[model samples]
Target: MQTVNLGILAHVDAGKTSLTERLLHSTGVIDQLGSVDAGTTQTDTGEIERRRGITIRSAVTSFALRDRQVNLLDTPGHSDFVAEVERALGVLDAAILVLSAVEGVQPHSRRIMRILRSLRLPTLIFVNKIDRVGARTDELVADVRRLLTPAVAPLGTVHAPGTSGAAFRLYDPRSGGDANRLAEALAEHDDRLLAALVDDLPPDPSHLDEALRAQATAGQVHPLLFGSALSGAGVAELLDSIAALLPTSPSAEPEPRARVFAVERDAAGERVAYLRGYGGQFRTRQRVVAYRREPDGRFTATRGRITRLDLVGAAVDQAGPPGRAHGPTALTAGHIARVTGLTGVRLGDQLGSPAGLDGRSYFPAPTLELVVRPRDPARTLALHAALLDIADADPFLRTRVAPDGGTSVLLYGEVQREVLTATLAEVYGIETECGPGRLVHVERPTGVGAALEIIGHGFFGTVGFRVEPGTGVDYRLDVELGSLPLSFHKAIEAATRAALDQGRHGWPVTDIRVTLTHSGYWSPITTAGHFRDLAPYVLMQALAEAGTRVFEPCRRFEAEVPTDRLGPVTSYLVRLGARIDGTDQIASGWRIGGLLPVRVEPEAQRRLPDLSSGEALWSSAPGGDRPMSGDPPSRPRTDGNPFDRTEYLRFLAQPRNRS
Candidate 1:
């Protein structure tokens, strides 16, 4: 059978999991339907997910749709877990972007669409929940066109929507306006269709169907389908559209390779990697090379043996501890399999070579950090280890353990913080107290500053660094790269970058130039640790004299609210430190555009409903940077206060701080 690695995406509470259940049941994958409210869904296997009635992790299940095997990846809908969605994006052949007919196009929906468009991923829009009380048809379609995209081909129209007996009817292309709509949409990209329409030739039904599939498969036009995943209204029609519109997985490649999109530890605590093979095969007990690229564009290759391998698919309960795979010795192209014994495997690792993989990120990492402490101080190490495990599964978290044993975590929003604390308690048996979230900022030097580390500092190495304002991280060696040894030179370079993680004001220092003016070490007693220890003290002191400015990430926003409510909305935005740039008179209201602090955007969105009497839509994009207003905020230092000489020496006295 053919394979379609399909991804279902949506904003939270949009019935995406319901849609997954409907698809599975209709295909005879299960005997009874699963309910999200009851926490009996097939994809939400974790205890917390079931209790909270939300998907916190991405889950996968396979079922037969017609003659094709659909590997459905059900991802988390919450914005805080968008990084999980980002990881799954690479393995998908086509995607169903779910939206609520009642809520219309939401901020997260728009964001997901923007990413899909950027990747040119073939997508189909499902306006679900047609039977819901406030579901809409025409007005919702208009919102999708204006906000999401203009190239949507409506597959059918709804009848008696928002009622239990709601029904959907596919368009009769030979009869009515559906033909005109499809032709017009395809005309922009299809010359033949454009010519036929221009010649006043309304093509036959088969011709229109052929044209629709071709355009949709190429990601030129999105096919729109309306349905209620709850009542199964229009779901069958939507399935037909999916099979008829979307493309299948790529043809096989002879070279042996697979890309790791997810990493999870099984019940036995063995690291298991979920990988999709692009070509060739990986068999049990076979050695494979994992190639991963760092943020700096350098690739690292590690080799490991696959002691165990299994194909990914569940027998009865698709949600039950995903990766409950069927024993399989080898995984070939177009197949997803879980393999164990790849000890050093990581998320996004390519098994083989990185030749054909794209290591570029579609989104930036979370820019907010919070210090978390274990309530029981004895469990601090355990909490840190648990956070490390979570970070392993979701690398975007960027968990850090301070030299003082303080733990900090990066997050996308407040929801993640709550979820994280609960997870640590329930899953990891660690109670925690989390500090307030702070925006991560960066610093750039205003002038030049230099410092030197001599033998008198009680270190075995002599190093000096001159710091100046520049673009990007520039490191030059005034002394020879091999003056002492290549190891010492590397230590100083790496330490310089690490030391810059926090500046004079506790923000990450970037966009600077640093030259190692001097370097020396005692013959054999002096190790790389000496230079590593010296590099930070010298660079940070230099940074202090240089004087740096802290800048926080800023959000560029645009909002639409009723004309009458514009005053209050404007005042509200201003209260949150927004700089209003312009306003234009739109059809239903005023379109306001401006920049707002990134941290305050969620609040603005939460308050928008009341401000505009529940008719306003707000959206923002992260861009640019603004000077942090008022007193500069300080982030929790993980370096044990290197600026103070006494603390620096005292911190190094501990065994854990030896590195």
Candidate 2:
């Protein structure tokens, strides 16, 4: 009768989808589980996802465990697909962070955890691949403590293979070896349970489970479960844990307000938004409010209503509440009710005033970016609209139309760029030519740049900035100006956001703060866009004279070989210009860490197959900038001449060799 929205997360190729299949199969959600290699997994639904054998989009499925309904969101593990993961987290009450028992914590895993911690979501760890050689649960737990989280504690054991071909009892917590650990860990979190244990009183397992679930939801402790999802050894126990420990969706909270996590257009040409309900129950034909565009650009608010609720095949309703109304469920991830009987509801629009309690406002700014151009100039406008639809569906995507008329969409990694390109052609009838992917960077001036007084079309004011590196990784903007009204000051804050949304590279800027030391407003006729245009120009002028630098992404690489391939690994690093930071000699091979430019990461992807002989783990991050040599940092580069949009398009159209 209750629902748990749980997202299964892991680093790419760490067997997340495999575990998902096993969960579906073992729980009887499906008669037979499909494999990733075979491309029949339910969660890998997109065309690109099937071909790539990776989850490019998030998929939702539901099953029953001990009378509770579990709605599982399987997200893409690659960094490029982090946008999907971010959206999934927004709707999820808890997470099951899957880690490779053989390899331990990875970069993408750490990134996912970073977001989980940022959102303050309760978490559980699933150490999978227990059947593989060198998959030591104890060592992996230690690694998780050292690298991921110290709060992670094991739940139970899964049997590994013995001398016989058949796997014996892997490891079960109830088998005395670690059966008492779950009880001890659960008791430590609850004072009453701890007292019961000390007084030699028999404690109820269900009561202890509820206490553990509360502790996990509060971010106090993250329980760990071990399994080999591919071998289906410990999957049943993992499903049981989900039923016992994960929190459930509220029955009747408030008005039906939902965060649209994903946007998908089905074969029927209807938009399907993956919705995470916050307060009220959303039913068919219920109207809601949507904020379509920013205030600066023809700001508009409209209304839309739900048309259909999607579910996963016949197995969906079996997990529903007793005597509940029966409905057809979309095979999409999460609770997605279609927007039908709508006139104006736009993407990223909140249905009602959001509740202030425990709600987060923003997602992580994108760390990667690409300049996209339509192969045909005639399709430019069409492509731009398509991108907006996509971005509306996925709030994590930040886009801005440059002054030159080129549109740049920020993505998290290479896979996203690929998916976008493929999707544009398939869904929108547009073939887009993409420039080389670049690490999205923010520029902060180091000194006082020029101050200019704006006396152009319906705007007037002098904006000054004594720019410098902000605390940690931010840009400090100090402004001095004439007197302005309090309402005008608020307008300046909104204008600063508009400026940050579209930086020089068509990417959203971050780590910067602006001071309205001097502020002013024109006649009431002047609108938000007037301030928006003037603000970015003034900020750009200030940044040009002040020094700016580029930031590259860093990677933590894990490689396993026959010990003979160590030299080859070094050779690969040298050729790729990656600097070695640390190395650990493992029992079978070695693990290494280094700093690598995110742009050239595709090479690491290709070489890892041969270098490790299919035994390698790779993860990387979008890192901060390093110091520039000699002179002060140069002016940040813009996309192209603002007056000539065609020039940039021409450049993008040319082949790399020709360029």
Candidate 3:
């Protein structure tokens, strides 16, 4: 039996957790079903998730199938918790992207597809909530093809059109009628399958399965499964599709490249990594070597014990060996193990699989930043340490301790800000005061600029360089070495990275190119720290020559509202400084699509629901750069009470200039 690692992802409140509960129930992993509204669901055991009625983080569960083990990860569908989903995809063998049959395609739904496509992950779409009245699976299926994929094909009809609360029967085009439709669709992906249909030769099950998996992973033949999570109709067949078609964990990998998707502190005050093994065998209590940092900021290889390994099914078991793990396991794909006393293991740390490769892609940069300060100034150091720990546990949550003195915690949204506040007050027992959280943005050179040259008189050394827009966002860098050996070019890149980190606006510079268009390294007499000391000054001096402009956060948004509300919606958009791109009538209402600036608080995406009387649907492409209006909006800083007038003013004074 093969083992598979799969993830369930959808927009917020799309019944992912409900579907997860049903999947577990049908698999016999649980004696009874659990409900998210009741807060009794297994995967949503996190206190934060239960209290908020939204998945603040991700959870894993596993069960058996046909003697095979399948591990399932349920990820938060909200755009704010995207970091968690991204990490999950890094380790997943396949993904089941959920869509609401009643609600149909959404902004976040498209965003998730883009992300999965980037990773080249095999995908299956489940059009859920089919049991609800007035759900149109046909139109929804059409939208999926138009918006997300031309390759999406309906698996089989579950709920009859215009019907609700009816018993669902699985369809197979291999049989007859609707099955023939599915067979015809399947034939488009494979010539042999088409030949089988023409010659009256029935296609074998394995051939269909293999073709679907290959095409799906290769961005073809997106299979859609319709189901009702509330009533559990069509769930069994959905499970069958996942079991029969999804690739299993440890399948098609040369060696293990495990990534730490989530991290939590054990009762003992040490960190434990939630690891997903992609291509290698894993054993409990085994020692693994990883690149980590020491207290003095030195990078070195450290050894750590696995401590315990959990294979999720029914209840998590401490499996001693790979062979002992369950096959066709349920919703969880990775193992949870406790480790302690290792100096530098971090949240996104890539651990070795006995094959020696460790480095992997780093997590995306944070999009929101706020200064975290303890109410009692005495706990400042403690607060600093705690934030560092959080950052260590989640690479995306970057924290920087300014040399001039202040600690800023980076996040993605208000939800993360709230979680940090709760964690600090409840978990750490520290009453913390947080500064106003603000949007995180990046800057790019609009025009070419030259690096400045300064001749060293004593403490100062002569250096020259140039900064310009780079070819791509991934490589916006600053180069400052006057001349370097081919072997030292990497070191120069490292030095430029150190400098690019904190631009004039104190944010990472992106999409901007820098060349030591010319530069002079410090003489032998100067200390090695000379590069560190001179790099910033040289960068700052170059800033004067090249000039600066701010880039504001922009979003691509889709807003749905009632047809009658179009006029009022346009009025609201005008007030919010948004420009419209197009408008169309959707199943529920009118959808206005366009780009909007991030500073437009009470943002249209957040307001459309209320504006439409809870009838509007909204979502945005996570983040991008746009034109800044010279004055950024002023919002209240909520880390503390809203009455802190001084804090409000300080937040208002934050640079409107993007970094």
- 1-659 per-residue lDDT for model 1 (tens digits): 67889899999999899999999998888788999999999998878888888888888888877777789999999889877798899889999999999888887788889888887889999999999899999899888888888888888899999999888888888974678777887788878778878888776677788889988998989989898888898889988987788888999887888988877777787888988888988988999999987543447799999998887652434556664544445788777888899988878889977866666676666888888999999998899889988887787898777545768888988888888999889878898998777788888898999988886568999998899988667777798777789988888888888788888887778789998998888887899998888788888888888889988888888899999999999999999999999999989989999998787888998999999999997777666678876787776677767788778778787897786
Candidate 2 — worst ten consecutive residues by lDDT sum?
162-171
TM-score of each: 0.91, 0.71, 0.77
Candidate with better lDDT, 2 vs 3: 3
For candidate 1, the TM-score is 0.91
- lDDT-based ranking, best first? 1, 3, 2
* Count of clashes, each model: 1, 17, 31
Candidates' C-alpha lDDT: 0.84, 0.63, 0.66
- On TM-score, the leading prediction is 1
Model 2 lDDT per residue over 39-154, tens place: 89988887778888998778887777786767788988887666677657767878899998777888878877877777778788888777777776667777787668766657
Ranking by TM-score: 1, 3, 2
lDDT of 2 at 180: 46
